[model samples]
Target: MGKLLFYIFCFLAFNSCIELNNPPNIQGTWELLSATTIRNDSSIVQDLENKRMIKIINQHHFAFLNHDNNNGKDTTAHFVAGGGAYSLVGNQYKESLEYCNFRDWEGHNFTFSVFIKGDTLIQEGIEEIEELGIEQKIIEKYTRVKVGRKRNIYATPLM
Candidate 1:
């Protein structure tokens, strides 16, 4: 009886661990709610309230844009844009930077933590800033933008 119960427990546990839908289809636009950076020593650097940010993901590609002054595309100062191939495995998200504003960033693969709960998406990543010579942790929160919404320069990165 003990062995039979053990086998039943194992079966149930293993079945629960299986992923019915691995790597969900998340090909759409996302509006950035917040972008914050935390230093290795626990110092936090947050983006200003007026800062503009957006992220767009397709079947196998993704794009991200961040700017401070987003009056329009013509005069978007402090603009930073990057995108490339992307893959999601469980809670892990990885991207290859094929093109970006910073030349040094291209051809690099960045992997980070990602969680999509309903319309909200949270991502956390760690990067080493060469200039600062310290490790920086980046946390970004976003909300999925449904279709037919008004797309603007700051909110729509792909468009």
Candidate 2:
């Protein structure tokens, strides 16, 4: 009985010291690094050279804003903002777009498969809107933004 008790104690101690691995948390601000859109048997890579976009995520919601880095001076300067509630289960993420500058995109739900490696996140999904005649596969990569760092050169309050 004494030997058995000693062995059981050793096993319990060993197990207590072993840590269980958990999935990385996805809550934070992420900056768009690259985006690729595919449709109609053609693929196009978005031009992000003169623009900055960032997505902010919290417990249950996410918001994104994109604008030209030229402070709206360029002829093609434009801005887009949208946000909504999101649900994340494992790597499956679903966004319920409640508000968007584009009225047609409001109330739409988009689902994407997300993967995070270190500080980088990659999202891939298909966006289809029959009424809008839009169907495309989008792959976007983002880098997590660190706190206290300037999000972009054309900084606004949204950052």
TM-score per model over all chains: 0.75, 0.80
The residue ranges of model 2 lying beyond 4 angstroms of the native Cα positions read 1-24, 152-159
Measured by lDDT, the strongest candidate is 2
Q: Model 2 over residues 1-159: C-alpha lDDT tens digits?
A: 999999999998887655222334678999988888999899998888799999999999999999988999979698999999999876788999999999899989999988887777888998887899999999988888989998643321121
lDDT of 1: 0.75
Regions of candidate 1 where Cα sits further than 4 Å from its true position? 1-12, 69-76, 129-134, 151-159
**How well does model 2 score by local distance difference test?**
0.84
Query: Candidate 1's residue-wise lDDT over 1-159, tens digit each?
Result: 999999999998887667533665567898787667887567675654556677999888999987776565554357789999988887788888999998777887777888777777788898664654647788877878878877433332121
As a TM-score, model 1 comes out at: 0.75
Q: For every candidate structure, what is the RMSD over all alpha carbons to the true structure, in angstroms?
A: 5.3, 7.4
Scored by TM-score, the top model is 2
Clashing pairs in 2: none
